[model samples]
Target: MDIRLNQLTMQFEEMTAVDRMTTTINNGELVSLLGPSGCGKSTTLMLLSGLYKPTSGEIFFGDKNVTRLDAEKRKIGMVFQNYALYPHLSVLKNIMFPLRMQKVPKKEARERAIEMAALVRIDHLLKRKPAQLSGGQQQRVAIARALVKKPKLLLLDEPLSNLDARLRLEMREEIRRIQQEVGITAVFVTHDQEEALSISDRVMLMNAGSIQQDSTPQQMYKKPVNEFVASFLGNPPINLMTVERMEARQYKLENSAQMVLLPERLNHERVRVGVRPEDLYLTDKDSGLLSGKVLHIETIGRDTMIRLKIGNTSVRALVDPKHQLQTGDICTLGADRDNIHYFDCDTGERVNVEKEAQGDADTADVEEYA
Candidate 1:
């Protein structure tokens, strides 16, 4: 089932939670409503599930307008973050509870419950109560209960938030696999960027009750629409340096004499340079543009986060963990000119800079900041 929100707006007493949001979710696509807290992602989910009627706007399940439809009548299955399961009921009974409420015959309900339990890999725990199961297992049961009804749409609200890191990873994959196997339209709400980027067919990044960017995970990371989207998507986050125009294609880092070569077409007197931590490469101190003293180092598996000080500014770079570097060691980092995102200093919008042909491109026309 495809979902559509047209001019969707939800207002509180004095504030708007969702502001004129318009988007289309295709059939069988598992899209994620992703953003930090108070971004209206949850409100939009409630609206999609028919729990909260929009203040103004229309919603369609395929082609049928159901903006004012009640939650119970939406034909949608939902999973909550808390794993709201019945302690008094066994796993099988919990999975069958939804059908039982609809007056499904006991035999048929039992069969369907068993089928869903197996689908979620919780069939072996059918006789256990909610309290007797692990966090991941209980979550599986909750998912089984939600799916047993075979609703046309499935909505998950931070469904893996309550689990441990490993369990969250495991359950997310399970959810993706099950969603594909059932061929149901799914909307997963999550504040975790990794969670949203990993399983979603496409991500709808939200902020201040508005859509920032609705695109594939790769696009959201590589080509963010604006400054916020660019800064918000990465792990260590993109390194942003405020540079002032020096002369022609030259720019100087703030409060320093470091010079950078921007695209020849860039005419902005002031722009922010955005480069991902991973895009930074270690180079000889005298040859690199941004050389500094290492301030901190954090190792995670095969990757290490190196924090360095360039003049009065702090910069982060993701480098190979095997490249030995101590806190006080001098380090220098350089990045491809084409990899940097130039943003307008005044509006925080991306400023396009045309790159030179491959044969004429210059990657290291820079000098370290004093």
Candidate 2:
């Protein structure tokens, strides 16, 4: 179930929903298409499922060209955001619908349906209708129905979006377990960054009808290709600062006397620095790189987020919950040299600054715990 999209473009009227998207989804690997709303993730899913023919380029499922294949003929199972279950049909009948459509014997279809239902943990609810099940149960039914067909490729478009916060977490884990058990290649579409990072082996981030970056979740977060990818992947969002390169390893912070030092000199004179909220550590004002006043403090369970105003710029830092910091407290924030990221100011591309005499940059400096 390896899929390759070669320059796949889907255009509707004057708008191009997907633009020259090319990527490979390896066999038995679950990859998530992650992006904001209207970023073409869902449209890409539609193209892959054969609901929309590509305006240009080709799609290959392994060695077979499936660009012109019909939706029903592609052997692709799709689970929509709304679940799209038949309210009038019983759970068993719904799960067996695909097999029934393929002219399988009633007894065989029933047996296979029962197995799939159990795999998704919905076997006991088979006698009930869609209306009788809860949201989570209904979603399980949808998954069972899609998987009962034993599809080679499974497409899930925000399957957990309709569930509650807790239910969404539970269902996502169940989906991952079922996908692993079936060993099917899955393409999941989701706008939630956490959900995408938590379940998928890799993530394809899309924006404005174009593919932003495709990489393993860890690589996508740790070594982002651009500002958009970095900003989109984080929960509290990566802190961005516009700064000027003073000399070799020195960068003058905007509207402040604070300075940032990297291991090596950047190729660009003007750059933007990116630091994650968790990377900014609170220290003594005299020892920190930047001094700021705490504007607000929020304690959300285990982590405390402190909003600070530094050098005419506002930044948020994640601190230990036990830290005795208040709103009026003056705090100094410092970022580890390896944790700081620099991008070309104009182009918004990451500037790979090499360590002096080292020839190349080292990523091992910052531990990739997150």
Candidate achieving the largest TM-score: 2
Q: Which residue segments of model 1 deviate by more than 4 Å?
A: 284-289, 321-329, 354-370
Candidate 2: tens digits of C-alpha lDDT, residues 1-370: 6899999998989999999999999999999999999999999999999998999989999999999999999999999889999999999999999999999999999999999999998888999999999999999999888888888899999999999999999999999899999999999999999999889888899998888888778777877788899889787999988887788878787887668665565656778889899988888765576667899999877899999887788898999877798898988888887677778788887777646422214434323422
Best by lDDT: 1
- In order, candidate lDDTs are 0.88, 0.87
Model 1, total clashes: 0
Clashing pairs in 1: none
Candidate 2 local lDDT, residue 107: 100
User: Per-prediction RMSD in angstroms?
Assistant: 6.1, 3.0
Q: Assess every candidate by TM-score.
A: 0.92, 0.93
